[model samples]
Target: MGYQELLQNKQYLFWTLQFVGWSGWAMSFYLGIVMWGRPPDNYGFYLPTIAMIGMTITLGLRWMYHLTWDNGLLTRVVAILGGSYGAAVLWMFSRGVIFYNAFPEERKVYEGGSMSFFSYFDGSVSAFWVMLSWSALYFGIKYYLLMQEERQRSLKAMNMAHEAQLKMLRYQLNPHFLFNTLNAISTLVLDGNNSLANVMVTRLSRFLRYSLDNDPMLRVTVAEEIEALQLYLDIEKVRFDERLRLHFDVDSAASEALMPSLLLQPLVENSIKYAIANAIDGGSIAISASVTGRDLELVVADDGPGLDLRNGRLPKGGGVGLANTRERLKALYGNKQSFRLSTTEPHGLTITIRIPLENTTDSE
Candidate 1:
C-alpha cells in the first residue's frame, strides 16, 4: 500500500506498532538478562514469554484507544491517559504473577515488599511511558490526515465557485448580443431591406448555434475563438456593409494557443457598439495576436472617438464588455493573465490581453 493509504489503516498501523514495540522490549530484556549476565534468568523462556504478554496487553489498549479516538480534545486527553495508566498497572501486575508462577523458588527467596515490588513498579512505569508515546503519535497522525482531507475539500469548493463564475460571465454576453442583433434586423426590415434582414437572421442563427455547441468551460484554440468571432462579425457586417471594415492579423504560431470559449466576442462587440455604430462614415476594427516567450498577446483596436478623459465620466466603451472580460480572465487565469484598456495614439480605443501560451490541446 502507498504511505498515505497505510497511514489511514488504523488496524494495520496498530499491529505494526505493537510488533516493533514488543520486539524492542524483548531485545532489552535479553540484553539485561543474557548479555550482561544480570538477573541470570533463562533468556530463551523469559524473552518470548514477556514479549507475547506485552503484545497482548497493548492489543487490548489499542482497542480502548480506538473507542475514545473521536471524542473531544479534553475528553480524549483524560480518557486515553487514564486508560493507558490503568492498562499499565494491570499489565505490570499480570507480569508479576506470571514471573512468580514461572520461578516459584526465586519468588520464595524474595522478602516482603522489597525488590519484587520495586521491579514490578518499574515495569509499570515503562509500560505507562510506552502507552503515552503511542497515544501522542496516534492523535498526531490522525490530525494530520484530517487536515489533508479538509484541504482537498476546500480546493474542490474553490474550483466549483470558479466554474460558476465563468458560466455567469459567458451568459452575460448573450443577452446584450441578442438585443443588438434584433434591433439591427428590425432596422433592416423597416428600411425595406428584406434580403439583408433575412441574411442577418441566418448569420445570427449560425452564430448562436456555434455558441450553443461549445461549453462555457471548454478550452478553445485561438483559431476556433477567431472563427466564432468571425461568425458574430458577419451578422454585423450585413448591417454596415462597406462602412464596417474588419481585419484579422493573427500570427500562425499563436493561432493554436488555448483560451476560454468565445472569450473575444465581447471585446469585438464593444468596438462595434462604441466605435462603428456611432460613426456615420464607419470605422476600422482590427484584431491582432502574437506570441512572445511563453505568453500570447492579443489586441482589439478600433478607430473611433475614443474615451473622453476630460470629464469625470469615461467612454461608453467600458461597459458590460470590459467588466465581463476582466472577470472571466480573473476566474480562468487568476493572477497569471492581464487585461487592460488604453486609448490609441491618434484616435480610438485598444483592449490588450496577455495570457499564457498553452499551445497543445492536452495542455489545457
Candidate 2:
C-alpha cells in the first residue's frame, strides 16, 4: 500500500507499529537473558513488568513530541533530547523498583533504598539511546508526510493553470471570419438576393450553436467535427460561389476516432484566408484523415500560392489561426502530438497533424 493510504488510518497505523516495535524489543531482551545462562527465577513476570513500563514511558514521549511538532527546530531538538532522557530515567527507576521487590536476597546490598545512584545512572544511559532512536523515527515520518502534502498541492495548482490556458486558446476562433460573413450577408440582401442571404444566416446560426454547445475541455468524434466544419464551409461557399472547391478523403476506420473539438477549423480557415481569397481563380482545399500505426494523421492542403519562406520559416504575418492551433495542440497533448507545415505539390500549402488515436470505446 502507498504511504498516503496507510497514513489515512493513522490511529491503526500508530497502534500497530507500537505493538510490533515493543514486542520485538521484549523478545530480544528475553533471548539475551537466556543466552547468558542464568535468567532470574521469576524472569517471565519480571521481564513483562519492565517491558510494560518502557511501553508506557514511550507512549508519554509520543504525546509530548506531538505537542511540540510545530515548534522551531531548536525547540523541537531540545524537547526530543530532554524528553527522551527524562523518560529513560523514569523507565530505569521503574525497572529498579520492580527488581528490588522481586529479589529480596539482592536487596541486602542496598538495604537503605530501592536503587543506588550509580545503578540508576548506568541503566539510564542505555535506556536513553533507545528512547532517542524512537524520537528520531517519529520526526522523520512527520517530515516525510509534510513534504508529500506540499508536492500534491503544487501539482494541483499547475494543472489548474494548464486548464485555464487551454480554454483561452480554444475559444480564440477567428473574429475576421464572423465580420466577413456578416458583410457578405449584408451585400447579398442589398443586391436583392434574399434567398441566398437567408441560407447563409441559417448556416451561420448552426455553426455558432455548434461551437457554443460543445465544451472546449471535451473531445468530439472525427465525424461530428467534420459535420461542424461543413456548417462553417457552407457559409464560406455562399460568399465564394464557384471560386471555392472542397474535397474530403476520410477513412471509415478513422471517422469514429476522437480529436479535440474545432481543432481542424482554424487550419482550414487559415488556408481559405491565405490561399483561396488572395488568388484570382480561388483554390481547391483537400482535408484527409487516416489511422497510421498508433496515431491518427490529418492533413489540410490547398492549391494556391504558399507562404513565402525566409530562412525556411513562415514570414511575420503568419495568421493567428495557425499560432492558436499550435498552442492548443501543445496544451492538450504536450510533446505527444506533432503539427507541421510544408509546401504542397505544384505551389500550395500543406499542414499535417499527428495525434494519438483514441476511439469511442477507448474513452469509455
Candidate 3:
C-alpha cells in the first residue's frame, strides 16, 4: 500500500510510531554521547542495532496491552506498568550481551562488582517511560475516532427517518381515493349508465397520472396543484351530479408559488367527505389563494354541518388524510407554516394554510 494508506491503517500506524519513536530516541542518545566527548566506537552500527531492538520490544508490548486495554482504567494501568517493566528487563539482558561481545574490556564493572536485578532494571529505566507514553496515546486516539463515527451514524439515521415520513404521506392518497372512485364506477355500470361510467374511468386515470408522476419529495407550482385538484373534483362531480359545485378564486400573481406536490388533495378530499357527501342537498366547496407581503395564504371552505367543537377543534375520528397532511406540513416547514381549522359563519368548516412566499417563478 501507499505511505498514505499505511498511515491510516491502525496496525500499520502502531508499527510506524514504534519505529519513529525508537529511532529518534537512539539518534538523540548517540548525539548526546558525541557532544560529551565520549563517542561510541561504532555508533553507525551500534545505534541502529539499539533502535531495532527497542522497536521490536515496543511492538510486543502494544499487542499485550491491546488484549486487556478495555478491561477498565485500573486494570489497563496495572497491565501497562507491569508489562513495560518486564519487557525492559528482557531488553536490558539483550543489550548487555551485545555490549560485552562488542567490547569485552568494557565489562569491568560486571566482573568486579556483585551482579543484581536492580542494576539491570536501573539501566533500562528509559524503556519503561517510552512504553507508558505509547500506551496513553493509543487509547486517546482510538476513543476520539470512535466518537466521530457514532455522530455520523446518528445524522444518517435522522435523514432516513425524514425521507420515510414523506413517502408515507405521498402513498396515503392513492388507495383511499382509488377505492371510492372504483366503487362509484361500479354503481354506474350496474345501472346501465355505460357512457357516464366511461367518463368517470377517464377522469380517474388522468387524476392518478398527475398524482403519481412526480417524486414525493418534489415541490410543484400552486397552479400545478390546482390542476390536479380540478381533475379529482371532475371525477367526484360524476358521482354527485348537480349536487356538487366547486369555485376557484386563485390570485393570478400567487399561482406560481411552490408547494409540496399533491399537498392540497387531502384537505379538498376532507371537504367532500364531511361537507358535500354528508349534506342531503350536497354543498359548494371554494378554494381561494392570495399573497400578502411575505406570506402565501390558501383557504378551502365548504357549506355543510361544520365541526362539533366539543372540547375544542373538530371531533375525534377524523380521517387519516387530514392527520397525514398536518404531519407532512410540520416536517417540511416546521413552525414557519400554519394550518388552522374553524367553523364558518352560518354552518360550515374552513381550513386555512399560510406558507412563506419563497418561490419566485411565475406560472408557465
Candidate 4:
C-alpha cells in the first residue's frame, strides 16, 4: 500500500536474489583464477564458467528459502551457510587437483601480500579460503532475510487475531438477539396477532440477509443499518403493540455515513430486549444520529429499569448487552472509536457510539 510496504515485499525478494547472484559470481570467478595458477588464456574462460555455476547453486538456495524454509532469519542463515558450505567444499576438492602437482612457482602466487603471506594461501589452501568466505557470506545474507520474513509473518498473524476477535464479538450478539426476537414472535403468534407476525417475519428475513452477508473489506452505509434496525424493531412492534414505540431522529447527512456492517441491529436488538421487552409498561426507544466533523455519533436511548446495578449481575438478554457491543466496536474501530454507556432521565439507559467515517474503508 505504501512505499515502505512495497520495499519490504516483492522488492525485497528481487534485491535479495540480485545480491546473492552477483556475490556468488564474484566469489567463484576469483576462486577459479586462483585455482588455475593464473593460466594466461584459459583463466578468463574458466572464471566466467565458475561464476555461472556458483550463481545456479545460489539461485536454487534462494528458491528453497522462499518456498520451504520458515522464511525466518535463522532458517535462511542455516540453509545458505549449509548449502554454500557444500558448494565451496566441492569447488575446493576440484581445485585441490593443483595441490598434488605442486611446484615452487605456484606457491609464489600467495607470497606477494604485505603480511608476508605464505604459499599456505595458494592452491588447495587458497581454494579453502575462497570457499569458506563465500559460505560465510551466504550465511549472513540468509540470516538477515529470514529475520525480515519472521517480522512480517508476526504482523500478519496479529492482524488476523484482531479481525477474528471482532467477528466473534459480532457473532455473540446474534444468538441473543435471535432468542429475543423469536420469543417476541412466538408471543404474538400465540395471541393470534397474524398481521403483525407476518410483517415481522418479512422483516426478520431481510434482517438475516444483511447479517449473514457481511464482507471483511466493505463498510455498510448508515441508511442500510437503520433499515435493518427498523426491521428488527418491527418484530418488537407486534409483540409490544402500542407499548413499544421507536423514535428515529437521524440527521439527513448521517444516513449516508459509513460504518462497520451489523453495528446498528445489535444495539437496537439490545434496546428492545432489555428495555421495551423487560419494562413493566413496555418502553420507548429513541435513536438520535448526527455527523460531527468526520465522525458519526449515534445514541440509542430508552426509558426502562436502570442497569441491573447489582455487581456481577448479567443483563436480562443473556449478557449480550453492552459487552458484545463493546468488543465489536473495538474490533471494527480498534482504539479509534468509543461506545459510552450511562443512565439518564427518570427511567432510561443511553448508549452513545462514536466512530470516525473519514476512512470508513476498513470497516466490515
Candidate 5:
C-alpha cells in the first residue's frame, strides 16, 4: 500500500496493529508456560484476560502520546518513558489480581486485595520492556509517515511551478508575432494597397482565432501545426509578394507526430525578420520534419545573409525568437530534447530540433 493511503486511514492501521500485537503476546506467553511443563487449569482464560488488560493500558498510553505530539522533544521523551513504566505497573497489578482470583491455591506472592510494593515491582520489570517497545514503534512509524507526507507535498509544489514556467514561455510568442504582423499590415495601408490590406486583415483574424482557441499547454500533430503555419504565411505572403519563397518537406510518417502547439511559429518569424525581409531579392525559407528511429527531427533553414560569424557566433541583439524557442523546448522536453543552431551549407542560418517521437495513437 502507498504511504498516502496508510496515513489517511490511520485509525484502521492502529486498530489492526493493536489486535495483532496483543494477540501475539498472549500466544507467546502461553507457549512459554507450556514449555515449563506446568500451566494453571484456567490458563486459556487467564492469559486472554491479561492480554486484554495490557491492550487497555497501551490504548491509554497511545492517547497520552497523541496529546503530547506537539510538545518539546524532552517533554515527549519523558511522557513516553513515564507512561510506559506507569502502564507496566498497572498491567502487572491487574495480572496479579486476575491470577490470584483465577487460581487461589497456586501461590501467595500477590494477595487479591492487598497492596504490596515488592510484588508489583518484580512483575513490572519484564512488563516495562514490552511497553517501551510498543511506544518506540508507535513514534517511529508516525515520524516516518510524516516525513513521507512532507516529501510528497514538496514534489507536488515543484511540478506546479514547472508548469507555470512553461505557460509563461508559451504566452511570450503570441504578442511578439502579433506586433510584427500588425506592422506589416500598417505598411500595406501606407502604400495605398487597400484591397491587399483587407485580405491580410481577414487572414490575420483567422490566425489569431486559431491561436486563441487552442490552449498553449496542449500538443498538436505536425500536420495540424503546418496548417496553422500556412495561415501565418498567408499574411506574410501579401506583404512580400513573390519575393518571399516557402517550401515544406514533411515526411508522411512524421506528419502525425505530436509536438508542442505553435512551437515552430517563432522560428519562422525569425527567418522572415532577418533573412527574407532584409535583402533586396528576398530569400526562401525551408521547413522540414522527419522521424528517425525513436526521435522526431525538425529543421528550419533560410537562404539569405546568414549570421555574422566573424567571431564564430551569432551577432548580439534580434535573437528573442530564437532564444524564446530554445527556452520553450527546454521547458517542454527537459533533457530529452535537443535544439541546435548552425550555419546552413553555402549560406543562411539553420535551426534543428530533435524530440522523442510520439504519435496521436501513442498519446492516447
Candidate 6:
C-alpha cells in the first residue's frame, strides 16, 4: 500500500470499543435496583463484571499494538505482557470495595473471582487470534490488487510489441517501390519526355516524403490513402501514358475512414505488376469502398490478365505484399477483419479487404 492508503484505513483498525463493568452489563436508570437489592455475602460481589471489563481493555490494547509495531519478536514479547493487563485489572476488582458494592452478583459470579486466572488466559489467546485473522485479511486484499496490476502491465507490453512490428513492416515498402519506379522514370527520360519525367519525379518525391515522415502505425483516413495512391498513379501515368487508366469511386461514408500505415500501397502495386503489366494496351484499375455495419468493405480491381484459380499460386515472387498485408490484418485486428481474392468478369483480377471499424484506434 502507498503511504496515504495506510493513514486513510486507520479508522477501520481502531474505532469501536464496548464497556462492561460489573455483573456483565450496566444501565444508568436500573443501576439503583440491580446493586442495592441483592442478597448478602459473596452473592453481593461483582466478579463476572470485572472479568468482562478486563477482557475488553486487554484485547483492545493488544489490537492497537499489533497494527502499530508489527514485529515478530515484539509480538511474542508483547504477548507475555497482554495477560498481565487483565490480571492487574482482575486483582484490583478482587481487592477494591467499589466492585463488591456496585453489582448484585450470584454464587457463580463470586466463583469467577477464584477463576480470575482464566480471564487472563482468555484475553491472551484472543489477542493472538485477533491479530492473526486481521493480518491474513489485510495481506490477502493487497495481494489481489497486485495481481490485477501485473495483468494490465503484461497486456500493455504485448500491445507495444505489435505496434513495433507494424512500424518496421511499413518501412519495408519504399526501397522496393523505389527500384520499380526508377526503372519507369529512366525510360521516360530516355524517350525525351522531360515534362513527364519531371512530373513522375515530383510524384515520387511526394510518395517518399509521406512514407518517410508519417507514423508507420498511423491510421490514415481513406481520403488520404486515395490521395497517396493517386500520386503513385501519377508517377505510373508518366510511363504508361494512354495505355493505363484508373477508375476510383469512393463512397462518401467510407471516405473519412481510417487505415493502417501504407496499407493500400502494396495491394495497388500487386495489381499494377501482375494484371496491368501483361496486357498489350494495359487496362483500367478500379478502387471502391462501402460501409458494412461496423466495418469497411473495400475492393481493388483491375481489367487485365487474371490468375488461374486452380493453381492458387503466384507466378514467381508475386504474393509477398498480399501475404504481408494479410498478416498485418491478423496482427492488428485478429479474426474480426477479413481479406479476400477473386477473378473479375471475363479477364481481370480483384482483391477485397475488410476491416472492422471498432478496433481502429490510431488516427492521422
| Candidate 6 local lDDT, 70-128, one digit each (tens) | 56866644544553444454445443444335544532475566644233344444444
Lowest-scoring 10 consecutive residues by lDDT in candidate 6?
14-23
TM-score for each candidate, following the candidate numbering: 0.78, 0.80, 0.64, 0.66, 0.82, 0.64
Worst 10 residues of 2 by lDDT: 112-121
Candidate 1 or 3, higher lDDT?
1
| Candidate 5 lDDT score at position 363 | 87
lDDT of each: 0.82, 0.86, 0.80, 0.68, 0.87, 0.67
lDDT of 5 by residue, 58-109 (tens): 9999999989999999999999999999999999888877776787666554
The local distance difference test score of model 4 is 0.68
Query: Could you give me the TM-score of model 3 versus the true structure?
Result: 0.64
- Report the lDDT tens digits of candidate 3 across residue range 167-255: 89878778988898999999999999999999999999988887778777778878988998889999999999888988999998789
TM-score: which candidate is best? 5
Error of 1 at 148 (Å): 2.2
Segments of candidate 5 deviating more than 4 angstroms: 1-3, 16-56, 99-123, 190-198, 308-318
Q: What TM-score would you give candidate 2 relative to the actual structure?
A: 0.80
Clashing pairs in 3: none
Candidate 6 stretches with Cα past 4 Å from truth are 1-118, 188-195, 310-318, 358-364
Query: What lDDT score goes with residue 13 in model 1?
Result: 67
Model 2, CA-based lDDT: 0.86
The lDDT leader among the candidates is 5
TM-score of 5: 0.82
Question: Candidate 1: lDDT over CA atoms?
Answer: 0.82
lDDT of model 3, residue 275:
90
Using lDDT, rank the candidates from best to worst.
5, 2, 1, 3, 4, 6
Query: Measured by TM-score, how close is model 4 to the native structure?
Result: 0.66
